[model samples]
Target chain A: MQRLIVWSLAGLILVPAAWAGGDKKNGNDKVFKIEGTLAKDDPADKLRKNPHKVHEYKMKAGANYVIDMITKNAQELDPYLRLEDSAGKNLAEDDDGGGFPNARIIFKAPKDDTYRIIATAFKGVGDYTLTVRVASEAQSILEQLKESLGTKQKELFKQFPAAKTEEARQKITDRFYELTADSLLPLSEFAQKYADDPAAKEAKNMVRNNLRQLEQSDSPGVGKVLRTLREKGPKEMHGQVSLALSQNLRSQYERSYQRKDKDAGKLLKEIEDLLKHVGENHADLASQVKDVQFTLKNLTVGRPAMEIEAEDLDTKTFKLSDYRGKVVVIDFWGHW
Target chain B: MYPHERSLVKRLENSPFALIGVNSDQDREKLKKTLEDEKITWRSFWNGPKGTGGPISAAWHVQSWPTIYVLDGDGVIRYRNVRGEAMDRAVDELLKELEAKKK
Candidate 1:
């Protein structure tokens, strides 16, 4: 059973890489699967508190379909979610983005058509699993993803040779853990890939010794920027300030989890306060702050639902719930 | 991705794609300067009490900077995790489907 489980896990990781290479459709477009999980299994490791994702799928016209999504917990914080067809019109939509730990948003697919799924987390921490399956459409993206992964893996080995040095090897191996240490099997598989390599073995030991360090590793290069903010305030590099702030908090949270510190709660509070403080003054940054807060709230354990109220530029007053019947996608963001 | 994600902001200013920007520069004057200098024409939404991120940030569940979601007319969620070429392709693809369905 253990070996079986290991094989299955290996398949999951290798499959995606395979599809990245061959298995191109008629259009030669790359395919990907929706299986597996994006968050840590412990539940404590998630800090999603923002709304920002646009999922799109193409389908044959006039087909019956359903979009399946899994939310880890239950909440009443409904965001606006919608589905629009290729012609720039809504086929089906709702005002609530919540109500989905594993939800199916059903719709009728027009002939030879494609659709986009739009949703905003109007209130709460966001740890969600989204899956789309249009049974009637002959084209299943999930199946395609699986097929693609099979082919891509072979190509990866062909083009990408093994790391040449301990430093170079450590980079890939370190990156793997730094990005996915919370993932038990992923960490294990990547380690096994280079089991024979001495550098890989050393790197794996380092990763094991500091597995928990993954959480603290959010700041790849922002440590200096974060310290600068602490000492000098937001006077310089204001644009990067927000990014550094998020990274700083992420690293701090990781550290707290590692040390089992008594100041965990206080640190979290300070981070929130700092975010709020940043939002209070930076009108443009305020949205970014809110979004980060929302993500933290959603993916955090034992958290309250978020409540958001916004005025649509065209409408008089728009409460997130008001768009309940339609799919509402709130882009509570802008780019620099 | 490599351009706005790779090249420089100046390149983005000259691209043909339409952009709706949210400036994070603390200084309004600086923000305005960047926009004017770059020849930006899209709408700008300032982060406010009800802006995208805030205590309400938890409300939207925004995990990172520069997030976007699309909804149907009745406000059902349709798509997410989009940016760069994926966003443009997805939007164009959806619009095409919507038009065909209507016809």
Candidate 2:
């Protein structure tokens, strides 16, 4: 039987936790390294959504800490993390904040107390490496913003499936844009005030992440949001913003072509102009610019299908052009 | 997908149409069994042992499975990822165009 373990981490809970064991010291900073496994027989959380393991740690008041749950195979062990007060109150939680399938939580202790850290698998089961360390003040603020964004994004994703009507879906999408804008507006201000700060790169990344979501959702407010970000956001991020806009426009062009819309060529021209601007201004994105132009020139509707010459299951080689006289459906398929 | 493809191939058996698959199954022997069991009668090019990461998919920049591209008799790409009823309609419309051109 095939092991269908690999799956997209999109919409999956991305979080992390640590164990009480293996406390190590790195200078004045207390470093804790915990290795653990989540199995099928593990206890599920209160909501019974995920199987988890819990650990307790003594935390100092007003101190910032960064916790990460790193798994060897993200496809098998999608880690989630939660920090709770001694009284079991949820302080903060994260999923995919450490990057897809891994989890990280940045927490500032409210008071001197023992805090419970919960390690769980969002899906599947495997081993993970959990580490905890004191975070610098600057890193903590940025990471906290990311954690909060992750939490809200998680909540919105949960509500997405239950949204039956188009109106409800649109409302949720609008809320996503609002949340993203709320988080970014402050960062944008900070970036402008401290123009030379290295944090601007991080700010750019946040914008890129939100733009990615916007592309997938195709929200009606996307154009307005993109305009606002381009005008108000850090100049360092303009390249990614342009790239995302061109990509979104490419999708629109494809859809228009599929529908046989008369105005499809207009969108193509817009995309071409956008890419040209990116190419001249964003030198780093030159290769990507070339790739987009190549696809536009060769792979668009009404273009000749690119020839594929490869061996079949029987080891007999054939060319796609061999079946030129027939109407063909080329399916890129996998059993899993 | 197999069932629908089977039906489409059968429905248009007499027409100048073909359904070609770039299959990303890792195990070729297992895929052969699946092909037989699923009664898949169309031609498929193997995407090699690396499965989805193989050369064909990389060249095509195909990010998802079951990504369909419909091409006309002149080998011009006409539609993409149109499935089920829409897939049938796209194919039928192209075949009709071919018929119209013959006249």
Candidate 3:
């Protein structure tokens, strides 16, 4: 009995706790070290609604810091970094709309406080190796930091001007043809850096937040893609979109058939057909709709999976059974 | 909080925002540390009054960590699902009544 309890405890909580525990630096710098699978990929791992991977760390005020994320599992990761105090008011955040598994991030920590270095990723990547280094105020800025941010920020600023109409927005958005959303941060960095100055921080945050939202947006890029296919895409773009989500992503968009697209009637029909054909088709676009449905359906945090309960480190049991009658939103996620 | 909530939090400086923190998550210490680090002295919790005595899990049918619900003084649930910045907007709108009551 003792051995069983020990082993179970280790598997469920101890091991992951060990990995979450940070490695202390002797004097100045702080690094957040996560070394193993925190949760053995839950069946709902891919179904993660909010993909913002948050990391928390403590750094000396006014000290230079570097944060790096080197991933091993999900390769399609585009990561954005941020620093926040406990109050949830963002002290510093990068709208870089970016990535790096082995990226070397550099910044200065505010004086005399414990701040969290949040690591946010886009795309579906695997395991990760994140390194954050803190340097004395005396250390010089790295080459990347010293490089001219002004020119780059201006270029991105001009290129990413607010879209007047959804159509106009679509035109610029096409340039972001990423298969899984990892490398979209250059603009994000520009926005945050110039937030307080002449540049519009609200607009910048909008874009960064939009990208994050789009990653979790269940509306699927399908509707927009469908519109483009007929007007700008291959002659038979309709059939292709149908095949992509149903065949590859493992999902179906049935209600879409009721909706009319000036371009692809047959394609919409095909999508419905695919869903009907497979009682439970897990379409790729299902990811996009997950957030939509999660929000629209009003799901809460504890009620979705009431039956599955895991034991914590302390000798106590948690049963989802207790929260059955209340609204529950299920969330499977990680943070620093 | 998301954009909508950002607006609401701004309105509630004098009003109370029932910002309860549930830390019976995979990272309790981190959550506690987060509040302290951010200097957010908002009233938070570790799974209700069980207070580390046990894992007071989805008892209220919570599906997310940092999940929040607003119940009026009358013992009725005024709002159910709230989160991110939108959640801020939600509780803020409700707290507006408190401000009005004062007037």
Task: Compute each candidate's TM-score over C-alphas.
Answer: 0.27, 0.66, 0.27
Off by over 4 Å in 2: A1-82, A87-104, A107-202, A212-224, B26-30, B99-103
Which candidate leads in lDDT? 2
lDDT (Cα, tens digit) per residue for candidate 3, span A1-336? 999998998788755554453434323333446642222332222223224455566665556675666556544554444566765556554433224334445666556566665555434444556666554332222223333333444554476677776557544454343212222233334444454442234334433443443332223453444334324432222233333333222111222321324434454445446444333344544554443333322322111222435443232555434443322222221223
Per residue, candidate 2 scores C-alpha lDDT tens digits across A237-294 of: 7777777667666766777887789998998898899899999999999998888788
Better of 2 and 3 by DockQ: 2
The reply for model 1, stretches above 4 Å from the true place, is A1-336, B1-29, B49-58, B72-74
User: Cα deviation of A104 in candidate 3 (Å)?
Assistant: 22
Chain B TM-score of model 1, please? 0.56
Q: Chain B, candidate 3: TM?
A: 0.56
Top candidate on DockQ is 2
- Interface RMSD, candidates in the order listed: 8.4, 1.0, 8.9
- Give the per-residue Cα lDDT of candidate 2 at A79: 88
Candidate 2 displacement at residue A293 in angstroms: 1.5
**lDDT preference between candidates 2 and 3, better one:** 2
Clashes of each: 109, 9, 59
Mind giving the per-residue lDDT tens digits that candidate 1 earns over A165-185?
A: 645654554344333322322
Native contact fraction, candidates in order: 0.30, 0.90, 0.01
Of the two candidates 2 and 3, the one with more favorable TM-score, higher being better, is: 2
